[model samples]
Target: MPSLVRAASIVAGAALLLLAPVARAAPAAGGYAALGDSYSSGVGAGGYLADSGDCKRSANAYPSLWHLAHAATEFAFAACSGATTAQVRDRQLSVLNAGTTLVTISVGGNDIGFSDAIETCVLGTDEDCTDAVAKATTYTRDRLPADLDATYAQIHHRAPNARLVVLGYPRLFELGGCFPGLSEAKRRVLDRAADFLADTTAGRAGANRAEFADVRGHFAGHGVCASDEWIHGVTLPLDESYHPTRTGHAKGYLPALTGVAP
Candidate 1:
């Protein structure tokens, strides 16, 4: 009797299990294409893909990281080092298409002379920094709008179905920390220029009906001068200087991309 009762209980449990509700399936992963310059390529984040060569697309970059997180069916990492807006429009747009359901870009900095401004500011006199900042500022405010318009239009046309997300630059410094490293004056102008660039990029993103991922807030208190720095301060191998560190991509860029892309 005990053996029979145990068998009956087991059968009843199995029947209940079979009748339990099934969980719904997850949403289909979209085709994601990462495009633009070194920021998107992850220049400073390290762990470079050897085939990427001079472009230095880091495994740790936000796009690569995002791709890993989503495990998307297709991912085209097309961003390159030193890529200007025209360069992106020419070289990288090929990966985008109607099939591509997600796209993210971090451009306009090169077009507005961010690297040049930083170079002059870090290596040149105060006057030089001011002049470089002034030139980049002028172009960013006046001419960059049209350049961005063209690029955004091309991207939208290429991936009409994709969710287009534009990631903006972060302020590279916190006021007093870099003190002796860069004059407070120089840091001020550089950060100011970064804000201008962000505003310009955000404006264009809105105009083109795309989402803008603003990373400045995430990078706040984590610039070069901060104790917990996400940006490098005049490091070796020239190209890495002033670029986001690995933590920057993970904590800064990644979250920004998530907020807008999702």
Candidate 2:
């Protein structure tokens, strides 16, 4: 009876040793680093984290929501409100390294005078809005691509193993809304600008061998003019306008980010 028990224990030890290699070969948990502008930082979503300060890094942002869904080995949230591509390259890229496995960036809108165009549409004359939209389109065509390429190159160099996802901006207005202040013509202009930004951003993402989130139609039924809007209209605090609401981040951007399969 003693000899039989010894043999059984030896067999169990051998089986455990054989399975050890298989467990070690399994994939590890992700390491995520979030970067980019106010869109990524949750400027209008409100309830900013205590230590976030001017970055306005909200607990409800898409990156934060995505982080909640996936438990990462290393998580760094470096996105800031009012950040441009240049700022991201200079300030945020330092947080990422070769070990990073997942990254999300929302940029390029600020580079082409996004806020100026919005202001012109809201306050300036119809002709001024058209001119601003036209200029923004032209800028997107000529300059935005190079800016994106430089930034993407830096990110690729820093986090060589990361699966980078570049998120696009959403169209702010809908066809008709309860407010009834903004003209459909102006809406079309801004809509075209948004489309141009998405196209440019997608092109750059493809160039970098990264995924593009393409958030164009994600906020379709819940634009700023919708009955139940996901985006904020002109708020008293100028920075809040044209930014996503908490619902927008959850329903719009979070799904888009998750679709990339971290």
lDDT of 1 at 256: 99
Model 2 lDDT tens row, 227-259: 888987755344566789999999999988887
For model 2, give the 10-residue run with minimal summed lDDT: 17-26
Which candidate leads the pack in lDDT? 1
lDDT of 1 by residue, 169-227 (tens): 99988998455477888999989998989998999899898999999999999998899
lDDT of each: 0.81, 0.78
- Write down the TM-score of every candidate: 0.86, 0.86
Per-model tally of clashing residue pairs: 0, 0
